[model samples]
Target: MNGTDLLALLPEGWRRVPLKATCNFFVSNVDKHSFDDELPVRLCNYTDVYKNDRVSPDMELMAATATPQEIERFHLEVGDVVITKDSESWNDIAVPAYVEGTADDFVCGYHLAFIRPRKEVLDGRFLFRCLQSRPVALQLELEATGVTRYGLPKDSIGLAVLSLPPLPAQVRIANYLDGEIARIDGLIAEKERMLGLLEEKRAALISRVVTRGLDPNAPLKPSDQDWLGEVPAHWEVQPIKYLAVVGNGSTPSVENASYWSDDGYPWLNSSVVNEPLVIKASRFVTETALKECHLPKIQPPAVLVGITGQGRTRALSSLLGIEATINQHLAFIKPHCDALHPGYLCHWLGHAYAFLRSDSDGAGSTKGAITCEQLANMRIPVPPTGEQLEICAHIRKSLDVAEPLQSEIQNSLNLLMERRAALITAAVTGQIPLEELQP
Candidate 1:
């Protein structure tokens, strides 16, 4: 059903009220450029509302300066709700956070709106919950508009409608949601921890089998490579360049529309490295673009590594299940099958991911880059062709079992998040009776 139809379902004693009728909406007067860290005031930024339910003085807020007039106008008080005024996605617009308590100098920052609800008519916490409910969120999403960044105009927000139950019922529903959501969040956190442990176990298994070989009784010798303390005596150590052809791809000029195609050669970027075996690209480029850009088509069964990007993407490694061209931010390595198994090389690179990223050199900022030269010189423990295949088989078999367990845990986490959202929506809309939850 449509949002208007959903709003019509408000129960008895619950009236649909324009938000402005019961709340005072104010936009921040201070711009980001005006912020001064030396000043003692705390600024409640967009993330404060988008990521949290309540703002507190103890939280790490951005420090800034505000003029006396601005502070007087935008200062946060208990029972005030802060909301995101703009975001990259429509679903994130108008997300709200209730102000429980804040430092004496706390003021709302730009790209946000401060909402002060009339205490006798509305509960700020309940209003915050209501704004996040499915019906209201759907309405907000439908109303938000922008070419690049979605936004909710102050007037539009003021005109938005919400189902307002009696103040006592509002309080009861909010209290009931607080306990139930907290319980669901706890389960999500535990599942997340389990996923982390599973990933760690998988990494350790890959590292051990790839470097040491599957045989526990294999004799060891000093490899003399700093990263490789020792390896099986029969194994050989070689720079990755000796065993593979390593290179990066290029992007054609985006200004030239002729360079792109609806269906052409698959063009890959560093982000595709996140997939276990990349077989498709988000966008394709024309043959003209490929030739003009000098993009190299990496053959299938090659290992792909992200050479640029923040966080873990720089260290991400994957195997290519199809022939594709990559952007400059990715390095493709085609291993010589006679010397090294592609799967074995991919797993070894995965094992050395952290070290490879840490040891890389670039113009500046080690956080998100690795040069082609640095990647070529990276060392690997190489076994005989037969041994390499054996090791790859062992690692793949272990992952065959562990991967499904990880997927199961991840599915559980996803369900918990959906359950949390559904529960909040149900409670705030009065679908769940408050009387059933009270002690």
Candidate 2:
């Protein structure tokens, strides 16, 4: 059904009101240049509205200076609602945050709009919840315009309508939501913490098994490498180059349509390195393009490492589950199977991510990358082939146990977010009365 049909379903004593009729809207005048860190005032930026339900003194707002005139024109007050006016996605546009507590020095920053509700017509908290509710949010998303960075134009937002209940009922609904959402958020946080612990445990298991071997009581010797510390006495410390044939791949020109095919050779990028085993690629290349692009076919069981990109991606390593070619940002290592197990090498590289990233040469470059020479020269702890297989098996078994628990927690978190959204929709739409929520 359309918005008009949804509005017709409002409860008794409720009426559809244009946002401009209920609130005074003001777009922020302060730009990046207006910010002065030395000033004592705080700026309520876009992130403050997008990520939070309320803007308060406790939030880490950016410090800036506004002239007395600017401050007088834009200073925030208690009960004011801040909304994101622009974002890269329409779903993020019109995100609202209620202003709470004494925020005398706070001014709206660029890309935000301040909404002050008329006391007799609207409650600030209620209005914030209404904007967040599914009906209004969907309307805002539909009205938002832009190709890359979506924006909720001031006029468009002002023209949007909300189904407003009497002030008392509005307050009650907002209060009920405040309590319920906080409880849901707490549960999500707990689940997220559990997931973090599980990840840490998984990483520790991989690091320990790969470096120290499965037999804890085995003899130890100094490896002389700072990252490896000590390995089993039987293990050898050798450069990766000596253990594998390291090479990179290429990308076919996208401008040439002939280079693309519906079903062709899988062309992997650095991103696929995040998966434990990359069995398929997001894109494919025609045989002609592969030959012209000089893309080498990476054999299965070979370790693929992301030598370029941002964050942990620069150090990510995974085993190729199929014969595929990679982009220049990825390096494939064909380990000498007779001496080193591919699984063992992949796990060791995964464990050494931090060390490898630190030793990489592109410290100051925008695209952080590890040179092929640097990767080949990097030292790794190598156990005997039999022992390497044992370690790999043990690591896999540990992950098999831990990963499911992590998945369960993640699923719970996703459900909590969905429940939160549904609760807001139900409350604001008058489908679930505040009285029904009361203990």
All models: lDDT? 0.82, 0.82
Q: TM-scores of all models?
A: 0.71, 0.66
Q: How accurate is candidate 2 locally (lDDT)?
A: 0.82
* TM-score of candidate 2 versus the correct structure, residues matched by position: 0.66
Off by over 4 Å in 1: 1-4, 12-170, 225-227, 249-259, 269-271, 357-363, 433-439
78, model 1: CA deviation in Å? 7.2
Model 2: which ten-residue window has the lowest total lDDT? 31-40
List, residue by residue over 1-439, the lDDT tens digit for candidate 2: 9967866788877888889999999888676444454345788888777777888877887877777777777788888888888875578788889999656687888889888999998999889888888888888788888643578878888887888889999889888999998899999889988988888888888888887887889999999986678988998888988988899987676678998887898888777877988887767889998888898887787999988743457878998999888888889899865687899989888888888777774435533688788778887888888888888888878788787878888988999999999998888878886569661
Considering every candidate listed, which one attains the maximal TM-score? 1
Predicted structure 1: lDDT: 0.82
In model 1, the Cα lDDT at residue 308 comes to 72
